[model samples]
Target: METTRRAGAEIALTEMPDDGARGDVDAATQIAAYRIVQEALSNAVRHAPRAPITVSVIADAADVTIRVRNAQATAVAGVPGGHGLRGMTERAHLLGGSLEAGADPDGGWTVTARLPRHPAPEASEGTL
Candidate 1:
């Protein structure tokens, strides 16, 4: 949230997932979540300064939903021509989840990802 605020955006965090919602997560999952928010905020700051942003994290027994949206987006820094979305998507898949990022019909940009409540099981040694 501070990232967006620092980027001149009026940020609003409507919801944050509780500890219970996080469930039995692992370090990689936590890092991925943090990175997703970091990249989203950075994009909003770099491309759409002064836009109002809403970020929410909702979690259930099975998965957690992360949403970051801006009211309007301009071509200040061009489209996602970098590794931002790609990295986020990779991280999502690593956690057995999915991420979707695109422009909203409301003329804003939105980045969303759903991550499983539990981390992917580690492959046992000598097991395919």
Candidate 2:
């Protein structure tokens, strides 16, 4: 959050359960969620410095969904690659989740990652 703010962009966070409260989530899931936000903010800060960015997290009984979006910036150049996306994707995947990062056809970029409440067996400590 501070990352994008420091870069001159306004950042807002929204949670599904409402009131912005983080309720009953596991450590690994929480860490993965934080990392996803961190990486998304890093990308916006570096590429769309003055754009508006929103981070939304939705959690239900079975899964947690996160979406980060930066407003369209006509001034930003041809776009950047990598930008911690690979690490973010790996984090999501390790948590029995999936991630998608892409530029919006109209403008800007969006990153979405979803993690399951009960992660799969393959997402073990050694696998990470």
Candidate 3:
């Protein structure tokens, strides 16, 4: 969130750990979540710099859910096309998780990823 702010974006962030257990998530799971957020933030800054962004991350016993939403762009920056979404989807699936990205009804974009707290052996072994 701080990184996005430094990039000149106003973000509203919400982070919560279920049962008040902040350390419930494994290192690998944590890393995947971070990367998803990182890419989402970067995309928001690039595609909609002046739009308000809201990020929510909720971690529970079974999984971590991350949602990054950016309002409609206030200015036309440039064309948008990239492999960021693909990479994010692959990372989540590799961790026995899932990701969804698309335009919101309000003319914005949203990226949501849910990664298991404990991935299967094979899934975790795969390169992200």
Give the poorly placed runs of model 3, Cα more than 4 Å off.
74-77
lDDT of 1 by residue, 1-128 (tens): 77557646788886665667444655566667778988888877777777888889887777778898888766575445678888888888877789999988878999999877666576111111
Among all candidates shown, the one with the greatest TM-score = 3
Sliding window of 10 residues with minimal summed lDDT for model 3: 72-81
| lDDT to native, each model | 0.76, 0.80, 0.89
Angstrom error of the Cα, residue 72, model 1: value is: 1.5
Q: Given candidate 3, what's the lDDT at residue 99?
A: 99
Clash pairs, candidate 1, are none
Per residue, candidate 2 scores C-alpha lDDT tens digits across 1-128 of 77557657799888778334456566677778887888888887778777888999888877889999999986457765674988898988897789999999879899999987657656635233
Worst 10 residues of 1 by lDDT: 119-128
Backbone clashes for every candidate come to 0, 0, 0
The TM-scores, one per candidate, come to: 0.82, 0.83, 0.92
Can you give the lDDT of residue 41 in candidate 1?
A: 82
Q: What is the TM-score ranking, best to worst?
A: 3, 2, 1
